[model samples]
Target chain A: MSEVTRPTLSDALTERMLELIRTGGHRPGDRLPSTRELSQRFAVTTPTLREALRRLEATGAIEMRHGSGIYVGADIERLVLPNPNMREIHAAQLLELLGARIVIEPPLAALAAEHAGGEELSALQRVLDEAGRHLRGEDAELHDANMTFHRATARMAGNSVLNEVVDSLLTVHGPEQREILQIFDDRRRDYEEHLAILEAIEARDAAQAESRMRAHLVDVKTVIEHRLQSPR
Target chain B: MSEVTRPTLSDALTERMLELIRTGGHRPGDRLPSTRELSQRFAVTTPTLREALRRLEATGAIEMRHGSGIYVGADIERLVLPNPNMREIHAAQLLELLGARIVIEPPLAALAAEHAGGEELSALQRVLDEAGRHLRGEDAELHDANMTFHRATARMAGNSVLNEVVDSLLTVHGPEQREILQIFDDRRRDYEEHLAILEAIEARDAAQAESRMRAHLVDVKTVIEHRLQSPR
Candidate 1:
């Protein structure tokens, strides 16, 4: 007999899979067994197995490798706290987390501005510029570019904790979560907002950079609220 | 013979024990094996077993029945993230976590102000008063009370997702983090700052409250930076 019996199949497979991934049993780049094999062993149908896998992918847990196979993702699991049950709006939680951000990131950006070699800044600059190129024209490419700049800033900070947490923010908006960008008819405003924040960071004006980054998130919040009111 | 075997006897016991707790293989609150019994069953000495058992208990993975026997502990082990790792200031992770906080929190406070009710506001009042009592006198007590007041406000916001995030922030504070409170010579001044922020919230002066909070945090940031600069 195998050292351990397989996990039982159920509607909660997605959650169980997540539990496995988060608990470190599933390392990045570990290939999952084929869906057929997994289903047969777990006594679940192929469709059921696929359903859980789909959600996992959506959350950036596992990636589909096309002809290759499904594998655990690298560095995708960021410091996302477990969500509380949905009843309250969790405002203070929001404020506390935000307060911490304001205190930390401005310094990181300032450090980046002073220490990041030209190559790093240019890479970030390129991301901002590319995001500008497709504003309101198309979203997927622009969104990716925007993320690249944020990650680049983290890389410049030389802090893994900072880098991982920022990326985790993007994780919350994982696959299809980007449907939020559709809320604004003229997302050019948001792009311009990003431009202001980046420019301040580049200028090594830490305070201005923090302020603009915050100002930009205001639009983001507005867009998020609108999208939630009537999903696309 | 027992089917379970491992490279190390302690490793096998740890695995079996976690499986027992997580799978409810043993009922909650049920007393577990004595060290003597565990050592005999696993063919390991008491010290090796103690090391494994200690690891589990430290993580809240299990509980000793207090001169009784070991039992299953609270399910802190269920959490996906290791908060202790994320909270260390000297370590490199704080900045990233803070970045995520920035994006989600300011609006949370504004929303909390918009929605916090009488009972919740009254609770905040009580916590503030209690916190004020010890602010200048005992540093440890003051930090605890101050955190209580802050947490009370978040609890008032009634948002689960936001609250969960805030809980993470609480876990990140330094073990002797309260020692920094002495940096402000007159604790009364800090308490008054807290009172002003509370009043601002109570009066529904969202702008004033937010302004006060940001200002208070800026002073705190300077103190913390100064402390970090000093010898450990």
Candidate 2:
């Protein structure tokens, strides 16, 4: 048998500290207990506790403010992948990405309807109103508006990890939508779908919100499929 | 407005090369064109091409072997997060993670039943038999076997990105599983459900595979919920 190497004391403490942050009823920007207190609680020396805190800081799971105290940073659970370059995306890849979004987003919309607070609901309303104005205008930035609407809906779902994954998926969806920009000629239909989804959200109708979102994606998918089938 | 700095020549070349890797007919382990040939094709100097190659290597999208030509590595699409430290997982977090799996895995099972080959199906059957032996012997390595079963199902789905994500999910599932190991008292029932799901896959019944997988997860979720509600 190969030799076993035990984990260093600091490494174990770092994991314990991270666990506390995750389940310790602490939010972002919440202060951690002082070094002296932490050391006593863990029954370790002050230097060892400081070593653990230093490691946590490196993982983006905690922040040490000079003279104030240690506070939680955005943390590992919040790290998102870099935005993918759209010019590099292939049609098949984009379609696969959209298929993934189709699977994930409707459920997210349902969760949003079940979870959104007044603040999140108003944020959704603001995005919808802005998107509507853009759709009505002659020089509309419809792509950005559409992305904003979906991203906002993701945020309303209240699961940080899911919200981040949806954002990454949209990095592909945003560009693909742009590639098929001309197919969204039915501006009124697009606007009404957005409004319907928003109304379902506002009414706290989870099932309706889910179905509306799914229907919207299916429409977009059909346009994309048509574009892929026909040559430019 | 911030000052606009144009991307360096190497950065542009890197993006172009990555684009080639994505859209090019190159699969993992396929040899890339010679550096001299590629530089000539792109009209870029050799140093710029080398810099770009370096970047791709760093991103894990390609590999370089001494005395041999450059080859496509595993690519960005296959990178999965490391297994999490389960000692840090909380009951609520485990429940939420299980819920995410419930939402995602049934569809994956359906996809798998559509895509699995004779070899893949046989591999799955082998895993089930091994797990059953462990259960019958009362020396069960249930956790590893359970993960192997789900991960194999994910692989059979034939979606690289989804498979990678499922692997990462199993990282959490693997360890949280150990924490709740006691609740799995009905090992025979667990084995039977897996067999049922595998039978659906072997029969190529996508809908039945999906429903069976969903029912299995719901059972696991119920167990987790019961555990969370009552203390030992």
Candidate 3:
């Protein structure tokens, strides 16, 4: 088991796989050659090929379905990604994540206010409406709805890279954010704050939207800080 | 080659490996069990264990030195990461990347101004001096120096997560950014704008630092946009 395999071969194989995808003009969801064909083509053993495939799978460059086949992953084109290996976040990291949101998301809300179109605004309204129903329901569903509102607002800002950044932040801290929902206590206030931000965006009031977003995140951060310090 | 190996086994093994690290309190750079030990502990074959290891290694959760044993990867705790498989970025993404920097980096400059200590400010000055030396020198060296300036400023802003975010953006765009250095073509102006930003940060003028950072990024974006539109 401690046999010295050439790690460089695995690396070069991964690069060649990427080159194959690029040269073939394969898009996400497109299928690639089966394992046998690929192994033969690359002249590597099954285990070696699997090593490269697993690497690509982990980073979301490709996906391997059990009985199905391999396809390019949806996240292959994304610039940033939530660390899939981040199973848990510490209290300090969670706060830093929120601090990041404090700096990045508010201006996105302002951009949302400035640029979101009619259909997009209506879509955002629908997301909040879903959250409204989940207000008294399962924490998981409510958490998801809340996350959706944040993601939707960021997307409506019309900058794909910023949207990716916010999405990645929200994703990696997801479990802790659910814990945050339980700790923060005032569910109604959370819902109302999101509504207020949405209203600002719908009203096309960029300044109001930006300030409201900042205030809302600051409120969450304040609560979390107090809770962390006083952990009853 | 497409033998029906249990994909579920690989997934579970990956989870267990992460658990092993967490339960053992293994920090980044700490060595993990060897391949032989891991195989015995997890009760899996070499191929199966290798798949799991490859996945973790791809995501920077672990490192597998060729002759040396396994070790915890330095990026194990990062919340966000640049896409390792991103071999090429399209022109549109390049512009959007610039747009994102314009939004995220300026406020960080202001924070750097407000919070950076004397030592940190001097370190930043040193980074700029390095860039000045490289301006008339190698493209790769100058590119590295310029990136260091951005990364150092982001770090000085004192938010680890934002620092990670900025670092990821820069990492994924390294090749294109080098190309940007050549196309933007005003090496002296690029160096001077960086100097002015450092001056503002050193002067503790948060507003000036913020505005200057924004203007500098906008200048780069303007040059890129003009070149893309005309491409002579």
Candidate 4:
């Protein structure tokens, strides 16, 4: 190992790299110098530079394509992120996650109703239609469609930070949510609830959209709670 | 450099490290085997191990003390985290952040009012008191106290996930928020608003607490918005 491989060296290099990005005004997808070039510029050996790059990559600060070069990551500017290291969530945490969605997503739905543009509304309709076709189809496709619907509505609320927060929650909720589709087992009702939310949004009925969202999430949580108490 | 210093090796090592942490049933702050032992166990060189360790450290999946060994990170299980690499916020992103808080925090304040126990309420009161003392003092201290007040109220709301979300927001909002304090420039009113929210929580008046919290954040956001329009 190089003498420069100490933790402090890596920490300093991370800070310097961030400074370089900021000073260079590199936006997401903008390329940074190559690893070899970066090491030469920073006067560090390749191992130390690689360690810093991995740290940046782990947190979505930067991207490192193997044969390609480095680029700023899309999530670098996001205020919130899903814990990338989360492998599994316990039952209690899963319910708490739903509770958070209950508190958060409803208001965003109301905002979506108030603010959604014509193009946005049609796109949202398309997402629901996709979900409808997959209602009886594979779990993964339906789950993706379902998640996209929630994400699109949150985006329509016109607050990127809230959108990031909701996206992070859904991303971390991924596996359990798929299992939720299996256990909640009312794929039709689930699809219908989502449709109701979409209709309310399309009609620009903010109150109706908000209440429907709350009801839908509460229903899902209630079913999950009951199932958890007596697992099949 | 070792032949194993490739990006794929680093990625594989990161996954293996996560597996080790999970399969070993380690909780936050639990000590893991030393780097030498971990290297021996995993059959990778020290440089590869260090790269993985740095990635984990950056994301708070693990902590590496300088001379001490590694411990599982407290944030490993959290569903949401502040983006650790956020260096600065643009004026627009900052406004959107406040808008997000306006949507999310009010409901939490109401929940805090409904669910806060005597001890938790007292603790929240103490946080505000700390803020009060620093009202005319250093900006950083007052900022810390105010943040603690918000975080404690979110915690008292009894949802860990929401608390994580709020904490993440506040964490990323740190530096810009201090600048906001100077711009908003009503230290006394800021302190007073926090007191009113705490009072409503203590009174267990959920409606009053929620509205007060909402109005307070709106007040701050309005001031910041105006200031951003015409900077000092």
Candidate 5:
């Protein structure tokens, strides 16, 4: 175990190669550098290079040949990729994300009305109940749960695009959100607002559901903005 | 040209390898079979395998080493991504793309009333005129133009998330959209409706703008449902 220093020369070399391939426009059926060439260039042992290559192969980057070199794969566009080294968002970027949600969430609610089955609705019912409970000083971190409740509604919408977008938005609650949402600290008012929206949905009134959702979102936006303007 | 006699053995081998990666849950850094090993398994000449591997490498799948063997690359997960593959209703998907737009557009108009720059509203004036022309029988494909017109409005909202969600919706409409919509063929009425909404926005009347947008969406949905229930 002591001899195994974490991620030896081979690991680093493999990472370098992967960076090269990704930056390069290698698509499915593309050929790679020969084994002898890679080992020579990276100044690593053949066995170590081979191990690293194996790891990449297992991860679905390329296909190996008996006598031939490795080839690339297909449809490499849909994966949840990370933009790790991105600079911080400007106010412009934050506004953009909010604008996107404004467009995306309504149809999401509509779809929820259309596709959500009993089980999905039941789960949402629990979220609503829990949110109500949380509003009344029951949970310290009600913000997280409240966010989850909205996410649950999106999931029931049965549209993968909506699901992914809403999910991504919820995961990164920026300073804007933390600053803006202190208004929810009032348990009674918040719970009442939530109940009105859920009750409208439970009644199977799509118009009412949509109406309530918009109003609620507006309220949220207003609160968030108010918080931004005022210091703690 | 004479040497290219068959369906290319390299191509066949590469496809097989892609299947293995997507289905096999292979990760980055995996090693590929050596030339000798692959040649024996696939019963192909080493040169042919090399051709296939080259293609794969071009696609960011595998890399070659000088003394070492081939290693897998990162970004493989993105290589064979999952997506809804419905290409038939490309047009309707475009309309459904509008489904998301209704959410952002009216709100955007209201926001513009409060926050948009003078330059922003001025840029859209030409778009409004063209839309009016289309409504008056200038062209049949105004429906398509109409969608873009609304998208531009969202852009004016100065919200990034709003823009991203709406655009992402358009991508999905690449296929699986035509089946969902039927143009009412009442271009005159539809165009007039558009003008009403646009006029409300220009006047900075947020309530009127919002009401016009909501009413327009309801009208469109009714038309869609009616068309579906009784199609020609």
Candidate 6:
């Protein structure tokens, strides 16, 4: 899908504005040109200019003050995902989330196996040990340990963007995982799965690590599916 | 990691606020209690209550009017991912995006095979047809056709959240895809791959569909990686 194309006036203007920021000539608080001046410069209408500015503002690239003018807001490179309501999530959404994990984590685990060094391996071990201590308790510490283990493995994968995506998705599942942990007796199995993933990564067995991680997430999806089917 | 535990004061208070919003007693524009009133009701300090309120606001649960009050802004059910800078994306980031796609699209294709009906299948066919027409054009129209084909596949997967996530990620790569298409002559290969995926979906061969999708994305990743290694 690699092909460059023509842009609409608003899109062109938005690109021009972003290009101006990217040159590092404009600081975060620097004001952009007024709508009138910008429209004249870009040969567009004020409404078109405003539309472009509004698009930038929505992206956190720039901001408009009620009485003042538009100014550069943030660097605009940092990506952020919206939060899903944990309390309001339905069974279908839960499956979708798990399905996403099932697809992502196995690849990430393989990457971890290929890329993980001693430090990352030790970090995974630390989290696994912590998880072991909390295995028998239906407590927040265990939940935290579980979250940390997955996140630590993502860290081991050494891909910042992948880590961010996984982190955000795990945050969505946080409360639900807690709820499930309290109601179901699955911590031992989960811990075993975590250990197996760690072992594969430590052994630098990318395929095994990938398959184990996929299997672990499948177990999670199964438990969640059963719970959703017979909501207790 | 199925473990539920006690909530912090702020966590408990946030749940209370979300509960009020969820009960349908408070509509989207309804005002939440003032800081003092809410803190008093929850028997917590105003700071503690405000912390909870800020958390809620971050999730799009409510909006705080500077001098007025907090009001329900939107339901906290939506998920939005920020668009990446396609024009300025480094090769590494492009590969990361492709890697993400490799994980996602295969499973999505499998699901589409299992779930897509006649209408969705026809939609996929239509996009594929459009893509075929654009195969020789190094223009934005071709980019749109390529994007629409993949998005149609996601739609056929019949998962709203998955569809949204894939759409946003593809949007991130849209311009870059255009640039690559303009620079490369691989459109025929891409079209053939798309046809294979479509054929698998049409035949209700989930495994075949998934493998085809994954292989196609892996090819994309390899091309981008080689290009990054030897920039043309």
Judged by DockQ, which candidate is best? 3
Comparison by lDDT, 3 against 4, better one: 3
lDDT of 6 by residue, B128-156 (tens): 88888877764788789888888899888
Winner by lDDT between candidate 6 and candidate 1:
6
lDDT of 6 by residue, A1-232 (tens): 1111112544577788788777857767888776666778788755455545655654457766665676887536544354534465666777777777787788899999999999878878998898898877647999999889888888778776667677777776677767767655667888898999999999999999999999999988887788778877
Candidate closest to the true structure, highest lDDT: 3
- Candidate 6 has a TM-score of 0.70
Q: List model 3 lDDT by residue over B1-232, tens digit each.
A: 3443678989999999999999999999999998888889999988889999999999999999888889999999999999999999988999999999999999999999999999998888888889888889999999999999999999999999999999999999999999999999999999999999999999999999999999999999999999999998
TM-score, cand. 2 = 0.68
Q: Write model 4 residue lDDT over B133-189, tens digit each, in one string.
A: 898899999999999999999999999999999999999979999998999899999
User: Which DockQ values do the candidates obtain, in the order shown?
Assistant: 0.06, 0.10, 0.74, 0.61, 0.07, 0.13
Ranking by TM-score: 3, 4, 6, 2, 1, 5
Candidate 2 — which pairs collide? Answer: none
lDDT of each: 0.56, 0.70, 0.94, 0.93, 0.57, 0.74
RMSD in Å for model 3: 1.1
What local lDDT score does residue A85 receive in model 3, on the 0 to 100 scale?
96
Clashes of 1: 11
Tens-place lDDT digits, model 5, residues B114-212: 555677677667676776666655443465566665666666666655544444454445333223323566666666777787677788887887778
lDDT tens digits by residue: candidate 2, A1-232: 1111112565588777877876887877888887667778889865456545644553346676655677887644543332232345667766676666777788889988999899988887888788777876643387678788899898888765566567656653555566655565677787789889989998999999999999988887777788679856
Candidate 2, residues B118-159: lDDT per residue as tens digits?
Answer: 999999999998898788554338767877999999889877
TM-score of each: 0.51, 0.68, 0.98, 0.97, 0.49, 0.70
Query: Which runs in model 3 stand beyond 4 Å of their true positions?
Result: A1-4, B1-4
Which has the higher DockQ value, candidate number 2 or candidate number 6? 6
A141-207 per-residue lDDT for model 3 (tens digits): 9999999999999999999999999999999989899999999989999999999999999999999
Please give the lDDT score at residue A192 for candidate 3. Answer: 98
| Model 6: docking quality category | incorrect
Q: Select the stronger candidate by TM-score from 1 and 5.
A: 1
Task: Name the candidate, 1 or 3, with the larger DockQ value.
Answer: 3
lDDT of 5 by residue, A145-199 (tens): 6777678877776654446557656544444444334543555656566667667
The interface RMSD values of the models, given in order, are 13.4, 11.8, 1.4, 3.1, 13.9, 15.4
Please give the range of 10 consecutive residues that has the lowest summed lDDT in model 3 chain B: B1-10
Counted clashes in each candidate structure: 11, 0, 0, 0, 78, 12
